[model samples]
Target: MDLVAINLIDGLFYGLLLFMLSAGLTLIFSMMGILNFAHASFYMLGAYFAYQISLYLGFWAGLLIAPPLVGVLGALIERYGLRRVHQFGHVPELVFTFGLAWLIEEVVKFIWGNNMMAYQEPEILKFALFHIGSNSIQAYKVFMIFTSMAIFIGLLFILTRTRIGLIIQAALSYPKTVEALGHNVPLIFMGVFGVGTALAGVAGVLAGPSLGTFPGMAVVLGSIVFVTIVIGGLGSLWGALIASLLIGWMTTAAASSSFQFATLLEFFGMTPPADLDESYLRDLWTLSLPQIGPILPYIFMILILVLRPYGLFGKRDA
Candidate 1:
């Protein structure tokens, strides 16, 4: 059905957005053991930075330049800030990044004002790319899908085939050993952190149009990114990808469904309350899937943690 098709496409787009953010977190928090609470801050920067750059350069230039700039900032943070805290263990690193997240938010509010900006898609991509029955799909959404796929493919090639990726992977397991082998492990960590944050930046740039560009945008997305990587499994690249898509589809499905708790109550052989407003559980019984769609991923995450502990594709429990 057209409805199913639309949901699938929408889910893929949402999933890819999550992937862009979660992919970086997996590399940083999962693979590299860096608790980067500020990762989504970089994502927020991307939208704001792109908005500023796009004012002078154009959307294409913003798309090209903003992420690298954000990446450089991330690398700088890793090199100067996070590296200094490394001696104190992950607790300090987490605390540092957590503080840094709030710091970035304050800086953004100072620079951009505490309001959402009009970060629209380019004129070229404003039209519909295709249609499903009566529904027209925006060209921008199609562009996002392809762009995310390209990034995923490029990243896969880099990690599996490239020399830098091999070195990075080696450093993930044995930083001291890699350093002993004459590789600059610290530089690798910086590079990984930079790239990871760059990916988040890309997501921010792409999502700003629909998600709204604001200082608090990062806060809205930050926890979801962690849930995604956790549900996917720590230290597992493929796990992140699977979990991102799964959550995306699940969310889209829930949002589009008409199902409510009342439906479930009937299946359980319970009579509907004659005066719903008077019932103590009126809200619970009347709640539709779409009403709780945003938190559905978290619910599923809790279930995964309770049932599987290690996630669908996790190698080991943390």
Candidate 2:
């Protein structure tokens, strides 16, 4: 029970991280119809930028500055680099982003070197926030949870209530009509793209210390974020949130449990091979869910595809 409680809290924190990154990706994809291969690269950039800024100004300042800086950089990329490729259609745009992801990785290596930075939590937030039985919950994790919740609420409000959001929705549904009505649709696309990348940047800043701030950090989280959006349904914010939390809990629960397939196989009347060392199925018999927790998202993704085809909340057309 204590383990379950601990894993639940841990999973929530991790889920928020995934939501932050996926939310931005959803916005960009919904507005621009581009699967940003460089989205996680921007996340890596955020961590590196925050780490650098934190050296001079401290963690809070890094949190404040890094995301906006990333947003501006994203805006520039959309206006100049991506916009230029847009005329050539999605294949070229995808290739552009794909090559851009590699470029960002190389640039990150050049600037930060191929090492994990000392991106520690703030001194003020270093202590345990609370405990579940013998397990202590760190203040930093609580802060991250709060930050994500705030961002989620803010995003929801912006999309549902704000004038700009209405305009964005209008542009999405009727880009030609919206433009005919005098709204700047292309500018809206650029803005959405920038905001999306910036949100990923925020997640990067929060995750860096916990996950390790390294050059390959993007590679580590990149595919998972894609899987998150896919499982949640492409371009669906609520779906992203649901899928993120589900994946988070699923992975955490799997990792925390000690259940093994061999035990289940025994219940099904399968005996362990006497020559286990040489048996082709030895690893399968010995493997635990924890050992393969990371792959659970992919499994869940395939299951979703086979069943729903679109996603939990994805539109039938999507």
Candidate 3:
């Protein structure tokens, strides 16, 4: 495979990882009507928690342990904190989460320190899986891909097949009606929120070694996850998936390519200024996927809002 194809695959995998973290976020915001800024903090927590667990047990065991612990934390917060704030209004609820985000980061820094932690992939999955031409595919990445796919499929099953899923769906559309129908809506909200945060935690556990366990990591990726939901359409799972993939591919492709601006200038028969800094253009020409990955989702979000206000798979009213 060419460099372009390899980069595209890399971005796609990264995007899927983002989707795992963001989809649960979309569900929480769309269903409960609260934007959780701390969602990415939970992802950070997952990474740290997994690191701790992996030290005692193993990487796989840490994966299993971290998410549930994060889920419990989320459930408690929702039951105690958010439920009380809901009596006020959406603004306070949002502010509370925003505060919670700051608190989580501070706590993380206190516990893990402000520096990036030393984390590594398991030895069994550390090597390259195969080589395609000049490109090599890592086993850890393949593991990440399959793990993400499993989570996606598992989520679909839970949200579509079970009785609780129906109730959750109903609550998203008509909370009052669901409450009136004699269901424990609050519990459902707590469960979903916990589940959602737990998913973010899982992403952290999987990504932490490669992404690093750091204090500012949550702040770095938090807004982009929100932007992913907005671009995908608020409360739409499929929309989030599509948006993630689109942003991932666009950023990766743009970063890997080196377009000749000089060719365009030559085509127009134009000349550069004698003292103009060619260094800046040289740096611009050499831009790579990782550098530009952060901004891609926001750009896609703007485009989606302008072009398709309802998003790709989002219902118009939703």
Candidate 4:
């Protein structure tokens, strides 16, 4: 029971972290119809930026300052780099963003080197909030949970209840109509792109200490972020939240489980050969849930795509 509780909490934390990254990507895709392949790169930038800022001003200050900086950079990229390529269609946009991702990764390596930075959670949050059996739940994990939940609630309110939200949504389907109403449609695009990247930056800041601030951090989570948004349905915020939680819990539970493939095979009336090395099913016989935990999300993604091409919450038009 204690182990289950621990896994649940851990899964929730991880799910929210993925949501922070995926939300922005989802938003960008919904508005601009651009996937923004470099989204995770911005996430990496956030961590590195926070790490540097934390050195001078502390974690709280870094938390406040770093995301805005990343947002501004994203805005500039939209205004200059992405904007120039926008006229060329999505292929150009994708290629540009893909190259940009590589550029950002190289730049990070050049600036921060290949080692993990000394980034850590604030000292005030270092203590355990509580414990389950021998497992301790730190204050930092709780903080991250509340913080992510707050972000989700705040975004939901803004997108569904606010006038600006209506305008943003309208612009997606009727840009000319929105522009005719005196809204700077292009500016809206830039802002949405900026905001999306900024959300990624925020994820980086929060995850930096817990996951480690390293150059390869973006690459590590990049593909998974796409899987998250896809499984959640491309543009659905609620879908993102649900899928994130599902993945978080699934991966966490699998990692903590001792269940084996051999057991599963036996349950299905299959038996492994005594000379396992010569058997075709040797690998399957030796496999354990924990060994495949990391790839579970990908497996889940394939299933989701196979069953629902538009995703769980995505529209056919989307």
Tens-place lDDT digits, model 2, residues 201-263? 999999998999998999999999999999898888999999999999999999988989899
What C-alpha lDDT, on a 0 to 100 scale, does residue 179 get in candidate 3? 96
Can you give the TM-score per candidate against the true fold? 0.97, 0.98, 0.92, 0.98
Which ten contiguous residues of candidate 1 have the minimum total lDDT?
309-318
- After superposing candidate 3, which stretches have Cα over 4 Å from the reference? 260-269, 277-293
lDDT of 3 by residue, 16-86 (tens): 88898889999999888899989999999999999999998989999999999999999999999999999
Kindly provide the TM-score of model 4 when superposed on the true structure, using C-alpha atoms. Answer: 0.98
The true-structure Cα RMSD of candidate 4 reads: 0.9
The residue-by-residue lDDT of candidate 4 on 178-197, one tens digit each, is 99999999999999898888
lDDT of each: 0.90, 0.93, 0.86, 0.94
RMSD vs true structure, all candidates = 1.2, 0.9, 2.5, 0.9
Better of 1 and 4 by lDDT: 4
**C-alpha RMSD (angstroms) for model 3:** 2.5
Model 4 segments more than 4 A misplaced? none
lDDT, model 4, position 279: 93
Range of the 10 consecutive residues with the lowest summed lDDT in candidate 4:
309-318
Clashes (candidate 4)? 0
